[model samples]
Target: MPSTPAIVVTDLVVDRGKKPVLRSVSTEISAGTVTGLLGPSGSGKTTFIRSIVGTQKVKSGTVQVLGHPAGTKPLRRRVAYVTQDASIYRDLSVKANVAYFAALYGRSRHEAMQAIEGVGMGDHADKLAGNLSGGQKTRTSLACALVIEPEVLVLDEPTVGLDPVIREELWDRFRALAAGGATLLVSSHVMDEADRCDRLLLLRDGVFIADDTPADLRAATGTANLEAAFLHLIRALEGVN
Candidate 1:
């Protein structure tokens, strides 16, 4: 992984109508690396992602992307966020949707088609996005994000509803993106996906339980896998041996 910090969060605190969502979270994600945000549902994973992308408001702390404040104009094209919900135009064809996003970035139709192919949605390019299956729609959404060639990419539960094959394909694409020097932060509740990442940030109850490499996390917890390590960490936090 590159030594430079691509994204930085310092003592972040987020609240949703008086209920704490993220509690003093802090971390530095390196450039040109794929970092997994692993956590259970309602563990502040999505909230933390929004904070990094500069969409969610925070009660305290600071989040910076590429040395500037998150969500600022300078980082607009440099950062791309793909939420769990596919944010494409349902009425538009897959190609049209992706091309429209490419247009926004002043990219050409060729680039739009290239992005669609990059996500393995080339065969379904002409299909209406609304008629696509869950996995297809997710890939279509990813194509839109890839059009910008962002420096930092954030994905919130991108593989949650995908099948095994599609999930594996997406992970491969993620690895390729990182290899090209883009910093990627992908969130997933599935423990099996943990090994696909270069580093992991484990969140629980609005705070980080652990932050380390997959192998190191397993070794530290004396577990055989990430799921077991997660459970062991939780039990230890609850004063269980």
Candidate 2:
């Protein structure tokens, strides 16, 4: 039998001020796989992530995580979400912030320390989060999420302000997490980053225009890269009869 999906959304819809931000969006994210959500600005990528995180209410349809309905606090506990804003305590030291988050997730100090070290932030543990550079802050946020050891990891524009080197490093860590059996749902405007995912879910005007592996998407669109394929798919969808 095929493995059960870690996440399932059936005919999901979300509206924002009379405008439908998501229209009947449906997709499944499998265990131990990295699924990238790709779209342009205003395409509702963040909104979609918010819906999955249960921070945004939908108008219709169903969402399930680990077979439990969305918005269940217990179910959410097993899913970690890292927003693009890096919502860490700016005044707190890196270690303290991570420890606090871990505690919220029921982790002890020792476990939090291990998680921080795992993200290569051990040396800067004492530095204030606000004093760190953009990349360091992003890494710290990711460390906090990892401290929970969640079964599902969701990230929105995870490497937004990071330099190329740090972005590559973060991608390596993400791949490692997936390899270790964690399910990942990542949203990115960067086509290069999206290409690294096990599968891609392309959004256009709040709808899923294409869902396929990078290789398959490229093949289907006869394009050389994800960006080109994305454009092609959007054009095709727009021209649908």
Candidate 3:
């Protein structure tokens, strides 16, 4: 028998006020691999992640984390979410911010320092979070999330506003995390980052139109790159009218 997925959804549907944001959507993410949620802006990537993280309640269907129903406090404690906006305390120093998050997760200051060093932010530990550049802030947020040693990590537009070098470094860390047996679900508009994932879920108009590896997607659409493949997929989906 096949193993249960680390993350699963069954006919999940979410409505925001008058309009529906997700329509009977279902997908699964397994452990030890990275799943990229690829979509254009306003395509419900954030909303979908939010739903799984318990920040948004669905109107219908069910979501399960590690085989349990969503929103259970125990399940939530094992999941970490990093939003597009920096969720750190801007007024605090990098070390202080990480220490505070660690405390929330029941870790000590020494454990927080270990996490900061592990993410390569030890040198800037004393710098104020708000004083750091965009990439630095991103790294700091990631460090805080890592301090909890979560089983599942959900990131939305993690590399936004980062330079190419820093983006590549971050991608390397993501690959390392997946290699070490963590389940990762990341949303990004950047094709380069999407290509690094083991699999991709293409989202358009608040629905998943394609779910496959980056190479498979490119081959299916006869496109040279992920961006072109996305364009082809969108055009084909629209042409179905």
Which candidate leads in lDDT?
1
Which candidate order results from sorting by TM-score in descending order?
1, 2, 3
Highest TM-score against the true fold, candidate: 1
| Candidate 1: pairs in clash | none
Candidate 3, residues 96-198, lDDT tens digits: the string is: 9999999998989999998888777899999999999888999999999989988889999999999988888888888888887888999998887878998
Q: Write the per-residue lDDT of candidate 2 for residues 17-59, one digit (tens) a residue.
A: 8999999999998999999998999999998998887889899
How well does candidate 3 score on lDDT at residue 137? 90
lDDT of 1 by residue, 84-120 (tens): 9999999999999999999999999999999999999
Write down the lDDT of every candidate, Cα atoms only. Answer: 0.95, 0.89, 0.87
Please list all clashing residue pairs in model 3, or write none if there are none. Answer: none
Model 1, global lDDT = 0.95
Candidate 2 stretches with Cα past 4 Å from truth are none
Which window of ten consecutive residues has the lowest lDDT sum in model 3? 1-10
RMSD of 1: 0.7
